[model samples]
Target chain A: AAADDLAFHEFEEAANLLAETPDAATTSQSDKLTSQEHVAVVVGSGIGYGAEGEEEDDKTSLLQDEKPQPRFWTFDYYQSFFDVDTSQVLDRIKGSLLPHPGHNFVRHHLRNRPDLYGPFWICATLAFVLAVTGNLTLVLAQRRDPSIHYSPQFHKVTIAGITIYCYAWLVPLALWGFLRWRQGTRERMGLYTFLETVCVYGYSLFVFIPTVVLWLIPVQWLQWLFGALALALSAAGLVFTLWPVVREDTRLVAAALLSIVVLLHALLALGCKLYFFQPLPLDHVVPAPQAIPPSPNVLLPSSVQPMTTF
Target chain B: AEAEDSPGEQEATSSKPLFAGLSDVSISQDIPIEGEITIPSGTRAQECDSSTLNESIRRTIMRDLKAVGRKFMHVLYPRKSNTLLRDWDLWGPLILCVSLALMLQKSSVEGKRDGGSPEFAEVFVIIWFGAVTITLNSKLLGGNISFFQSLCVLGYCVLPLNIAMLICRLLLLAGQGPINFMIRLFVVLVMFAWSVIASTAFLADCQPPNRKALAVYPVFLFYFVVSWMILTFTP
Candidate 1:
């Protein structure tokens, strides 16, 4: 009776331990059996167990015929039950212990995955190529020709124009295309990108319109108007794109003031040209040529004159 | 002992007279205001023929005196004044344009944020371009060279041009951040360098006489390439 009672207690403890364990596979199967029991029991417990007789009978008969199982035994049940060593079981439990919780998270996330090298390579390659080609062309040109010197004025204007245009137009389009390709859908363009495009194209207009208008139109006033418009638009575009990134407000205000000054200079230049460049009347500027120093004989009396010419 | 010490002290206190020995050797070195003092009748001025010798000596003395006076003047008025007097012609425009460029960059960047002005950058761009064009045209006309030759020659001018621009910017834009200054300088240098190089390469192989004409085109080519690159790459 004591042996039977101990065996029953052991089985009950084993079942409770299994139910409490949080292993995914064990919990799922156990939940499945419990739901099955509830459905069977709702109809009628005795009828449900009797109707599920074949499966239940096989499990029960197997358990009854088996020898009394040892408590806290090894999973190797086929071996002699008497040979179960408690020390070996304890050693196995100790062997499966885990480290502190936060340690593994750092190891998994931070230390692995060395995959950024490729992207860096691509960026470096592109930057180097562009820089080399651009710089080489400029250097070689200057070297071969003593005259083609890159003046500060030229450098400032061209660099500003080119840098602005690139930042405004090219980078955005490339970004947009990259995103479209990557996501397989169009994304709303960034604000800066739009501003950059406007600024670049607007500035280009500033360059082109004046060139065209000044060349094509004889009227200085119309050309001035076109030039003014171009300048305004270009400045507006630049400000729109750059203002967000600037840390100081004073500089922004100063830039606006400087623009006014530049416009004034332009106006002054135009005024000078208009005032000084009037068409000259030819007759007054070029006196008619007299006969080559009237021959020396012509100045003297005809009697003393040489016979060579009249 | 005290009397001897007194003499020694007096001797130490007073400096030896510099011309002491020459006092009795004057021999009428000073001219008389009246009729010149006569030597012996046999040794008359005409007999000695000393007028030419006197005139030459006077000239030598005058020249030496003038040279010494100049030396003293130079020592007294050294030429180290900090006035903006020298080379204002070159410096003024350079300083003005650089300050303007820096201001434009700053303003454009700011205006980009606050959404106020758009014309600031455009005006600067035009001014710079105008300056370049005027310089190129003037150099060409004055040098009696063709446009291409001007460009070829101008291509070599990029380095000095950038150095001047940088110096100007440094003087004018002193309060700005180092990083900002460096970046601006870098971009300017690269663009100028590249354009000048390309212009030179293109114009170098072009045939003589006209080869000089090809110089300016490199600058123009640099402008073209940089503009295209910026248009194509920047954003």
Candidate 2:
């Protein structure tokens, strides 16, 4: 009964909106932006709560009845995005971890309510984990042999934090902008909010958590195996989630976008593994030999003292 | 949607009367004050029995200590009850976090030649930082709980990890061996899972139905990181 009531109210509201602005249905993306109120309602109901809104007609008829108010720059407006619960988050994490062959994660799990919490904390956790584990691996290596001069590289924490955070946050922002720009030219392309894009990238890092632990093993092949596994899982999740959005573009553009995403992800995992977990340099392995006598050209303390006495 | 909105309305209505009743009681009780003024000796006798300064102080202290201890017991055997939530306190969590950090500090100092104070601070910061971030995440996820309640649960769940850290420290005394390392690994892994289970059990009810996995993942990660630290303690 409630769903029926909501649907009736949505139908009535959308009809009124269409009657008020007869040309809204036919406007381009640029004109849609100028018509902020119309776009806000459409985006809120059509994309924000799109789980049951499959058809374009149904989408236009649906409304985000849950939004208390639609005004941006209000705390309440932003609060709605944070208003998710545990099971949904866990489901999203699982979606990212195990990519279904044909399924789109954004459509399946996160279409209705994409969130920023996962993206922020997942990146933060990954950064700290990498830094700490990387240092621990170094310490373990140093312990295996006593001659190596090892110091705690505190800078790795800062560097890791910056690199991972920038990749997670800025890359998504840039991707969202690029997609939006492309969306203007190509009306057939699927629309994605910035939050969904960031959410996908954030959850993709989950595979790296266990992989870093595996990297602690000193074996070269095992470390590489862990890195490759992490790279493939993360990239697969990203590609599967994003393919629907990019598929409508030219084949060249679509392939370019996917390759860039996968390449960036691969680089993050491979770079961290190689830079943070590499073996000690050869110089650190063997100490300078202590038995060598002083060269004849070099004056010893005793020789200098005899000359001073004369 | 109406069903969801109804509870919120009910809560608002339910809270309204309690405030009205409080004011009503205060007004009605005022009449007794004048009556009591005429019977000062009797009132003084009642006050003597209830409000002797030292006795009241000791009683309050005992009550607080018992509250903290009961919370610890609940943490050890987490169940779907409101006891932890209703009377949430940070005393137990503070103690556990401090002790866990201390254990980490002692082990690292013994293992490394230059185990400075930063190691201790690092563990301390990581724990409190993780707890605060998780609590904030839960809040952002629209959890129907208070901030401190979430923090208390996350903190108390570290008890198992603290025990694991203690066990690892003892095993290290026997010298490093493959068998000892395996045993330590097993202990840390078991305790890590225990921490996750206990925390999720406490937190499961507060999370929204579809988003339970989201809230639980962070709890898992937080415990896993601590467990990793315990497992890798070389000394």
Candidate 3:
């Protein structure tokens, strides 16, 4: 009878514990719901670090949309052209330097937002570099033999700047225009924006920086090797990156355009190396100082004659 | 000693009267002195007299010149980019650019049959143009920097190239020889690298991590061109 009474008490205790658990569970569940609400508020406020900044950027963009778009003639319109960050620029440059086998740099890297910043500067820098380095190689050659009469040619800078600018900008413009003109519904994939073409050309010249620097070494074989390597890399980069854009064109047109690109790049590389890095002609001596009449009497007559004629 | 002490004592007594006169004015005005008369305690005010105008002007000019010199020294041994960014000025750059252009410029009046060399304007334009374009490139690359600050650094970094130009000029005067040529080459190459390194040192912090190479390439090219001009500069 005692054992039965004990068993009954044990069952009552078990039932009491079971009854307390639901109350505890309900309170805990309510606490979780409240905590979740707090988390939602925090997220909503955008007080968090990484994702919040993105949210802020979105907000700014949305605000900008609310404002009227700037006209094309205004500075604000062009301001949008420089909207790339360092990582994006670097990625594009790297893509240009080393062309990936299967990647379309245009589609992958530059589709949404093509930038003018890299192309503009790259062409300018290349123009300056080619002119300066060309002059330097000539100077280096002159130093090896004092007998050779060499004057530092400054015209190269202007020439280089113009050439590079034209190639980087105008060629792209023409290519873009041509492709657009030829593009039809059937050949829609062949068209790339003018900026995209320029961007490719501009970034493609990056490999030449180190190559031109290497050209300073004065080794014939080494210089050629660098020039060839650079040309191949840059041309390959341009050709392959632009291949998909021209893919939908007829085989002949595509082939012709691609070959022209490769040819122009080669011509530029070869021209820079040959013209700028040419050795001093060992056969040519410093031209003897031209005979100017040392006599004041003779100089007076010549000077007076010019004045008289005028 | 007695004479000095007597005068000092007399001055002290006289200064007391000066304060006393101030207090008398306050008393006469009937402004109840709520607090002890606090003699407007400060260094005696200086008069803007004509006698010191020249001296003051000279002092200011000297100070500005000294600051420019300090900036030049800073470029030579660049420890921090902030030294440049803190007080960016175009003075050093202007001087360097002018001197470089003067050195590099081939005057058409010199009447050489070959007129292909760069004119003064060309060199000037290239230097300024290259710097402006490079700065624009950095700005476009989303670098957190200002235009003038970038220009100041780029311009100042031309110091090495200028020095190399000077050396090359001197070496050219020594007459052409293999040894002289080698020295010129070495100097030009070293200074070229120095210029690129120095500018990059100043510019590297402003660039984003991944695109440092992108930003630096232009600077490298800019200096390389200038150094090339320096190296190949024949009389």
Higher-scoring candidate on DockQ, 2 or 3 = 3
Q: For candidate 1, lDDT tens digit of each residue in A173-210?
A: 65334433533432432223332333223222223222
Better by lDDT, candidate 3 or 2: 2
Q: Please write out the lDDT profile of model 1 over residues B42-124, one tens digit for every residue.
A: 33333223333344677766664564444323222333321212111232233444443453343335435433222345534
> TM-score of A-chain in each prediction?
0.21, 0.70, 0.68
| Per-residue lDDT of model 2, residues B1-235, tens digit only | 2224244433444333334433424355355543212222223333333343424677777877899888877877878887888878888888888888777664444445554223667778878989998887777665778999898889888988988988998898899776987899899998898899888998978876666777777888888777876776654
True contacts kept of each: 0.00, 0.38, 0.62
Error of 3 at A68 (Å): 9.2
Writing each residue's lDDT as its tens digit, candidate 2 over A158-272 gives 6788989899989999899999999999999987888888888888898898889888877655666667777888899899888888999999999999999898887677567
In model 3, state the lDDT of residue A164: 82
Please report how far candidate 2 places residue A190 from its true position, in Å.
7.2
Clashes of 1: 66
Q: Give the alpha carbon lDDT tens digit for every residue of A57-152 in model 3.
A: 443343334335669986546656765656678888888887867777777677446878788777776777787777667567666656656666
**What's the best-to-worst order under DockQ?**
3, 2, 1
The lDDT for every candidate, in the order shown, is: 0.34, 0.70, 0.69
Candidate 1's error at A41, in angstroms? Answer: 67
Candidate 2: segments with Cα more than 4 A from true spot:
A1-53, A56-61, A70-79, A82-109, A128-162, A177-191, A206-263, A281-310, B1-62, B79-81, B106-118, B170-175
Model 2 residue B138 CA deviation in Å: 2.4
The TM-score of candidate 3 is: 0.64
